[model samples]
Target: MPRVEVAEQPGVGLDGSARPSEDVVVVRPDAVIVLDGATSLRTDLPSGGWYASRLAAAIAERLEEPHPADPADVLAAAIRAVSAENGFVAGHSPSSTVALLRWTETAVDALVLGDSPVIAFGPGGPTVLADDRLAAVPRRGGGGYRTRLRSGAGYGPDHVAALRESGAAMDRLRNREGGFWVAEADPAAAYRARRARWPRAEVHAVLMATDGVSCGVDDYQIFPDWQAVLDLARRHGPRAVLDRVRAAERSDPDGSRWPRPKPHDDQVLVLVEDMALA
Candidate 1:
């Protein structure tokens, strides 16, 4: 069995209430699943966190089956069940990113369905499995939000409006041929996940990061590389990395450097280490 360590905290809602992060993590003796739910922009639809919670439970139930299935199959069955339960439509439904890691005595399987990334570490540095299609989507006003944020527009109504606009634009291309894909109401998206496998002996550790925690390594450049991230998490624990991310965001209060949707996002990180003696 792999040893797992995790750290997570929910981001505050617009009302400043303690809202749970849309991100969820499920770990078993041989597997770890991470989900980052999209925040809902519409009141009529269920919140992303709400959807992710039920989806995670469904995934957990499927994983408990006596006969194990492939990682993609697991996600597909869970998505199908949840979408049916909620009467979700393909393009108009709450969604979440998925990162799955499953290991057996002989091999380790990894899959990334969205921005959430799965990194495997062994002798050859670290191998990162990520879906970067979302980043390719254009922002409204030609990336005006980041500019406005850098120019000192805090999380006011204007920023909120920009988010809504960008979200709608992104939604148009979601799960489409050229846009990007996530675990939404479409079970087929699960098959579209990026997948990789490695011999168990080749993997010493694995780390899963939601977009919130990953933005640090991605945009903030806090860690030099994936190795640095793994080192920090292994040494100080995942919460320490979250603290670093939060501190950096605090440093750039107005988001002059890292212009994001919010000052802080839902932070979730999981580190699974091989228990075999070196």
Candidate 2:
């Protein structure tokens, strides 16, 4: 059987921000799934956290049964189940990202939606299993080609420094116009954006994390070692990692200092190893 491990961190903002960590993860013999709720949009059904939690739980439960390897049906059912239970569709329209990596006896299959990435690693280093938005703020000057930014914390040094010096850039980073973020809501696009090559490789470990974690690293640094992050999580635990990230973002001298009552974006990671190979 496959082994699983998980960690979740809450962002640093708001009265009940600590209560609404939107990161979710699943570890099973056959697969691992990670879900990250969006940060911009709000929901009436208790808040964005409800949607993210319900969707993750529903999907995890569905995976317990035999189903198609495609994450689309899994997500579609999860959305319906959660929405029905919540009783109001629009009340919980927070968009979120999804990363699901399924391992079969002979091969591996995966899917991703909205930027939360899935990475598979081995001796050759790592390869991305799936790619999603992973960004909260929209790219500059609109259109798909522009570099997407994040709200509050997670801005690049130049942007952060500028925002710290002047309030104007902060406003731009938080702007909802030209396609800002909305948490836990169904992604405007499907999570099944790509497929992965799990069978051909001698997999060591797999990782999935939200933008909050990715922000700490460089864009070119995709698929940083899962073992390293997992080691940090193991030694310090998830809460500590979150606290450290919050502190770093809060104290970052770069002008993009996160304002008080910071948004509590949930952070989570899923780690797994191939049991058969072991």
Candidate 3:
């Protein structure tokens, strides 16, 4: 068994209103799963947060059916089931990134679909499992919105228009070949997740996080590296890491410094440590 510590907070929208976080975390006896739903800008479709809750439930249900089910297989089945439940069409449905880490008596397994990542700390050093396809895909001036925000534009009517414009543009590339894969209505996307395995004895701890929390390291440089993140989580608990992310956001409230989509995004972190390591 592993000792799990977690901390999560809902995102604050541009208006400074708290919204239910689209991030989900599932801690099974043998696995830790994290999902970060993309924010839904379209009114016709269901919200990403709502879709993520249903997907998380589906995933949890499938994990209990048999022992050590392949994470990719489980995710595919869940996506199929969830898609059927909502009768959603590909390229038009809400989506979420996935990060999964499962452990058995002999091995540790990790899978990452989309931007959410899973980091495993073992005797061999830290191993990161992440899918960067969404980021790697080319876009039409993808940084334009952020740059606008940083240039004293602020989050106002123009920001909303820019969001709509970017969202429509990205819709064409989503789920398409050579573009990016995410957990939407397409079950095949789950199979495209990144995967890795390691000897159970070698792994001492695992860290799973949604992009909101990870942006602190990946974008804002809040802690330097993943090793530093692990050190903080192990020493001060997962809450400490979240606090650091929040503080960073607070310092740049108007998006003048970081120029993010929103002032504060939904944040969630999970640290699973081997009991033997304790």
Candidate 4:
């Protein structure tokens, strides 16, 4: 048997407004799913938060069916279901990143799209499954693109316009040639996601997290490594890891230390422990 626990927290925008968090966490006896909705650059379509929640629910429903299916097939089906329900056209709606893990009596399977990650801890140590192609997209403004968004001195209308143009360019590259893939309206992208499998006896625990919780280690270097993260979760639970991330973000409110587009992002973490040891 496996025991699962989860924790989540919504992030506030720069304007000090409360909006729905775009992260979703789903846990089952033999599986875990984590999704992070991409922020929408267009205003004419549904918000990413709405898309993520709906997609997550759809995936959950599919997983509940008696017949087992490949994770990629399940995700593809869920994407189509959500798109049909919302009347969203491909390449015109909001999208999300996905990370999934499923375990059976003999093996464990995993998938990752966009940047969210699924990590497995085994007798050999920890193995991280992530997709970094999205982050490799070229930026037009070198490194100061995020700094220009702040008001007071360096902000300018031209900078904002440039940022918008850059965003549009990135959107075009999505799900196309020389570009990365995500859980968008296009079901074909699901097949392009990274996938892996391992013997069930080799894994002791697993963790699925959106970028918000992972950024603390991958981006901020707040902790020494991923092992530190697992240890913290084991001692204080998933919320403790999220609280540490929020505290780190608060300390760098100006983005001086970490130059990211948003001050904080919605955080979601799920931990699955193998109960056989107990």
Candidate 5:
């Protein structure tokens, strides 16, 4: 059996109040699943963490079933189950980013929705699979669009209205024509997720992470590259990498260095190592 290592940590909100992490990591005999629940801008709906936990549990259960099914189908079924149970409205409820990697002796299968990334390490090096369309949404010319939302900036009615407008604009693009996809109330988005397969022989290790950890590399430019993240996991552990990320965030408490929605978002990581090569 392949050896797997995992780590997770909840992050504080901008006010330094601790909350349950919305990120979830699940490990099976042949797969690793990572999820990042989207923070809801509105207060009337259930928290993103609530939706993520239910979805993650449902997905994990589907994966553990004996019957064989396509990864996309499995995810779709999970979404339907979660939505039915929670009565969540499509395009109006909390959602999550999905990253999954399932492998057999012959090949490795992958699926990615939203920004959570999957990195596969092979003899050729590391290949990173991520969906960046969410970030591609045009931002206002001034910086700190997300930072202002949660930086305790004393938002007035105009500020709140502007943020709501931005969110509505982004919503129109979700899981639609020329728009990015995610595992929300709609299951169709699962079929639209980025999918790939690689020969098992070509893959030596697989790392799945939510945006919290990946932002340290891709967004914050903390590490030199993806390989450095893998090296950090190999030397210390997944939690060590998260620790470094937290340390970096502490250095930039006021978003002057890195303007993000939250000062410290939840972090989750899973590393699957092929024992045959180890």
Candidate 6:
């Protein structure tokens, strides 16, 4: 069995009430699962966090069922259940991004929906398992692409100028038209899961995190160094990282620290290790 560790923080609201952020790290008979909820600014209720927690719980329950189905099928069923439970009609109010990791004796499978990222670190570096939803936005002219700053340090006149130039680059990208795009969570297509073998030599750690944690993260496009992140979490605890990200966003004038909006979204990070140690 694999042991899992999870951390999460809440978001502040207008009336001084802090909305709950949902996260879970569970070890089921089939696999270890990590999930994060997506909060929307448009909603009056706390659907994001609410759904995140509910979804994770539901997934866990399904996995524990006598005849657990495929991970992908189970996820799709959960999405449909949420829609029925909430009366959330099609093309309307959705809940959260989903990231799941299923480990069998021979192979491991990963499934993700939306921009929330999941990463795996083996003997080499980190291999990103999911896509960043925001990366799909088209630049102004489609000539260049806009890159978000990892932190306050990424902001400046030069970066701003590049952002403007990237508008054209984005337009160019739009013209090509044959690339991956981030669309709304598809309870169906997002169901396609990927699988890979766990190398006996180099499998060390796998990290699953919501986008909020990515705000202050660097070299993330590549596999992030798990030890370094673990060190930070150990010294300051998870909330410390969220605090720094919030401060970094506030320090920037351009609002470039988007996604890291004030009050900040709930940050969820889950770290997993191979069961060989056990």
Worst 10 residues of 5 by lDDT: 150-159
Expressed as tens digits, the lDDT of each residue in 1-278 for candidate 4 is 78898999998643445788888877777778888988776779777778888998898888888876899999999999998888877788899999988877888999999899888898778899989888787666543456554432222344445556677888888988688899989998899999989888888888888999889889899987778999999999989999999999898875657756567788998888882343
**What tens digits encode model 5's per-residue C-alpha lDDT throughout 210-267?**
9899998888899988899989999999899999999998888755577665678999
State how far residue 135 of model 6 sits from its true place (Å).
1.9
Best candidate per lDDT, number?
1
Alpha-carbon runs more than 4 Å astray in model 4: 142-144, 147-163, 275-278
* Per-residue error (Å), model 6, residue 226: 5.2
Which prediction has more favorable TM-score, 5 or 6?
A: 5
Whole-model Cα lDDT per candidate?
0.86, 0.55, 0.85, 0.82, 0.82, 0.56
Tens-digit lDDT track for model 1 on 1-278? Answer: 78899999887664335777889998887778899989888888999888888888888788888877988899999999999988999998999998888777788889899999998888877899999988877656655668788788777778888778777878899898889999999999999999999888888888899988999889999987888888888789989999988899889876778888877899999988873322
The residue ranges of model 1 lying beyond 4 angstroms of the native Cα positions read 14-17, 275-278
Taking all chains together, the TM-score of candidate 5 against the true structure is 0.90
Residue 95, model 4, lDDT: 95
lDDT tens digits, residues 222-248, model 6? 214545665566576656556665566
TM-score of each: 0.95, 0.66, 0.95, 0.91, 0.90, 0.68
Query: For candidate 2, lDDT tens digit of each residue in 1-278?
Result: 56666667666433333465766776766777777765432223355455566777787888888655366677767766666675644323555667778776666667776567776776777677545332444333531111222233333444333333332332333213443322233332344355575663477667677766654443323325555565565576645544555555555432233332133345676666553374
For model 1, where is the 10-residue window of minimal lDDT? 11-20
Which 10 consecutive positions of candidate 2 have the poorest summed lDDT? 143-152
Per-model root-mean-square deviation over C-alphas: 1.6, 7.1, 1.8, 2.5, 2.8, 6.8
Q: Let me know the TM-score candidate 4 reaches against the reference structure.
A: 0.91
Give the better candidate number (1 or 5) by lDDT. Answer: 1
- Residue 30 in candidate 4 has what lDDT? 71
Count of clashing pairs, candidate 5: 0
Candidate 1 lDDT at 127 equals: 92
